[model samples]
Target chain A: MHRMMSDKRTIFLMMAPGFAVFFAIVFIPVFVSLFYSFTDWDGISAYRMVGLHNYRELLLHDPVFWKALRNAFLLGGAFLLIQHPLAVATAMILQYCGRAEKALRTILFIPSIISGFVTSKMWVQILSTQFGLLNRLLDAVGLSTWRQDWLGSSSWAIASIIFVAMWQGFGYAFLLYYTGVKGIPQDLHEAARLDGATAWQLNTRIVLPLLQPVIRTSIILAFIAAFKQMDTVYLMTQGGPDNSTQFLATYLYQKAFSINLYGYANAISVLFIIVCLLVTAALNRMGRQEVGEF
Target chain B: MARANPAMNRKSPLGWPFGIVMAAFAAIQLFPLLWLVDYSLLKSSQFFGASILIWPKPAQWANYRIAFTAGHIPRYLTNSLVVAAVTIFLTVLLSMMTAYVLTRMKWRLSSFFYTLLVVGLIIPLHATLLPNFFIFKQFHLLDSYGALILPYVAFGLPFCTLIFCGFLQTVPRALEEAAVLDGLSVPGILVRIMLPITRPAIATVSVFSFLSSWNEFIMALTYVRSELYKTLPFSLLQFTGQYSSNYAAQAAVMTVIAIPSVVVYLLFTDQITSSISHGSVKG
Candidate 1:
């Protein structure tokens, strides 16, 4: 027993595989990215240290970087202002939905379950300038004047992207809020009802207050998701119509793979890491505030 | 408006509004997918001319055949399956082992290592992109299964480990004590006693990692350049790019790529919801 207790080798053996793989794939590469960010390593070239030159250029000179950041913030705001509230309300309504709850939840979540590629391509077709479903529906409803290029035009591009992103994410948010709502003790609602609490009052005061933790979680996740937004935008428009819908991920990919600007891309990546970590830390700090007395 | 009524009537008046909202959202949710399926069976001309609400008169089943044969969807499907299966196996095993150590063992660096693992969760994959590309290129692993599987396993480790660690902590210490009395080693105890009990956590992690890897795009797109090695998402993206004008074939490819994931979701809907909510709340 003593020998077994003292055996460090087994513990090391157990930790070795996961740590090695994680280090090689995730950890070491990030530091390598940091190092490369300070150099001019363009795929094939033997490069010398540029030492923050890439960072300076990306921060000071790049209009597209600011555009991407702005779009990401817009999407994040939509998640908070539009998606989360809608998800919570739907989840609340779903509780009262009785028999159709499971089916409705499943239907709402289906978009989330499908691949981004399929969703983006399908939306592209549905947003076709001439024969899109949105346009055709408008025509059918005698609102043909509203029909326009949804994904093609610069004006509607970001909103269209946000709508698709929100659609894809709606299910997960609903499920999260639904699960949170379900976790609330039933007797509280019963007691509230017995005390003459109205439905709106019950939800706002009792259920929603109890769901603050879940809401915080959903907000943080939605923000990070918006920040990391790439796949749908890449497939749908490739940040097109003059980079109108550019995102950090897509822009980084374009800079690296498309144009062979590995050093410049790495610099963008360093900022990307900083932004993600700061957002996460900030949210965590904010969530550390007063715990509800309930 | 009295809240003192029986539960049925108290909720009954608002039922219509809730039902209407749910039905409307469900319709909105389903419209794009239904349109995709509808458009997958039509020629481009037919697709452009047909009413958006209407189905094709004569469905073009050949699109499926063409997508499968000419578009190399079967190849992509097989590649996705292989990569996802292997990645799931490795991720679950590695996560279980790591979690077992972190929770059950008395290692000095456990917290530090655990923090390290958690950092993987927050590090944007885009940040890792160029370095991974360079490393893989150096190792001559580009356009290969290794490139995909390694990154998949690595990125998947954090969340899976978190889930497994949460589950492992709940396992009664008495079981391990009994195993120790019977001369079982730590690994043996993990294999014999812990693995069986952690089945649900394993299932959750497997489902999540599998789905993510199957639907993964950026890594597959950046690392793999060969048509022979592309996964479903990458293949679909490439096929759509090549045939941007052929809406039917693009839709067909999308449908073929989408079925596996949707079927997986249907099969594991309970696991997905339960596991994710469990992680979020506990996390």
Candidate 2:
């Protein structure tokens, strides 16, 4: 058994195919992107090496890059501050609900499963000015003054995009927290109850502490997702209303495809990876102090 | 079962409020889908009506017909299925083999390869877009199904491998040892013994691969230029462009495109949800 398991030939055969594909498609392209970031290649003509010129411009000159970076951070902050707490609370509420838990859980996760294109288009229609459901509903409720062009006006565009993104993403967050909440041993709850702890105290003191790891994981995932936000922004707004909703990925895509600034886009891609890694590393370091060892 | 908490077993005083809150959230989550189906049946003129939801006195099923024929739904749907099916098969097979080698086999560089593959989980897809485009163009793979399938399979490998490694860790090694005692070779044991045991993981990997490749838009948009190989989601973009004023038909297109994902999710909700928590927590 040892001989067969350790056969170098067998290991080589098993590992080679996946490694080849990963290297060619994913791994090598990252380096190639890094290489192209230095050259002023426009996808067709010969180019000269710029040597950190694109990076300098991106950092010091590009207003859109700054705005995109800020927007990405804003989205990440919203996820951590707004979406997560609400998700945890909802997961706790569902924990005690006897029979309706599964149905509600299923319903909540429907949005996450559907395509982003569908959700973005649906939200666009709902947020439309003239025939939009939101405006009609607001008027029906006698709050006609409340309605605005949700995606048209620059003021509301980013907020609308955030709201749509939150709606689309809330289900997965809820599920993660739900899994964490369910993993808490019922005995812990029982013990807390016996100790004369109120329900609120049971949640705040016991459940929240135990959910630290899950909270950390969710936050990191949210940050990575925020940096990776492209499809919805592209489909919904296309960084419109004077680029109010430009995300890093969408901007890189526009620079590459639309403007044909392949070199600059590659630079953006490199920076994109750096931002994701930095944020992930920082969060992981912060979470290194172990909590909830039970 | 009897020892289950009394508060959980019966309706606590807070149950009503909690249920209402959960129900409202579910409604919020589900309303857009319902509104979508509602509007897909209405005429284009009725879209601008006063009511938010105007029940079609007579449903306009022609919207679906137009979308199916004019939007090239069948062709795009077939292309998407081909891409998704091939991607899922290759991703599952390759990742399973990689996971087996990483977990079961002894090697000098096992941990090295493990870290190398797992680091891919955090590499954003945007980093590879331009370089991959140039690579495919050089290889003459642009505008072909291979353009999409290769990348999808590559991206799917890291996550699927992580899930498989996690599952394979929990399986008792005695199964493999016993199989070895039966004169089975390593590949034989992996095929007959390990494959069947990893059915749950396979289900998880398949669902995830299907979701990503099926709804994939950006890569498909960039890689495949021809209409023959365009996927389902791309058809929505084209339909919206071609018939910009036809709101109902566009809604119909979206509804049709969303059906497969919805069905897959409903079918594998347990596997999908469990694998998400397992993969994220461990990874």
Clashing residue pairs in candidate 2 are none
- Model 1, span B1-283: residue lDDT tens: 1122234234577777787889998998898898889888888777766377456778899888877765778788899999999999999999999998888777678899988877788888877888899899999999899999999999999988988988887777887888899999988988899889999898899999989998888899889999878888755555555575676777888888888889999999877887778656654
In model 1 chain B, which range of ten residues has the least summed lDDT?
B1-10
Report the CAPRI category for model 1.
medium
Model 2 agreement with the true structure over A185-271: per-residue lDDT tens digits: 888888998899988999999999999888888888887888899988998899988999999999999999999999999999999
Candidate 1 lDDT over A1-294, as tens digits, reads: 446644689889999999999999988987888988999888887989999899999889999999999999999999999999999999888767766767898898999988887788788878878878888888878998998889889979888999999999998999899888877776787899889998889999999888988888778888888899998899888998899999999999899989999989998888998888888888888886565755
lDDT of 2 by residue, B1-283 (tens): 1134455547477777788888988997799899899999999898888787788889999999988887889999999999999999999999999999999999999999998886788888877888899999999999999999999999989889989999999999998899999999988988899889999999999999999998888899889999989999876776555687899999999999898999999999988897779755864
Q: Which candidate tops DockQ?
A: 2
- The number of the candidate with the highest TM-score is 2
Give the CA lDDT, 0 to 100, for residue A98 in model 1. 60
- What is residue A280's positional error in candidate 1, in angstroms? 0.8
What would the TM-scores of all predictions be?
A: 0.95, 0.97
Name the runs in model 2 displaced over 4 angstroms.
B1-7, B240-242
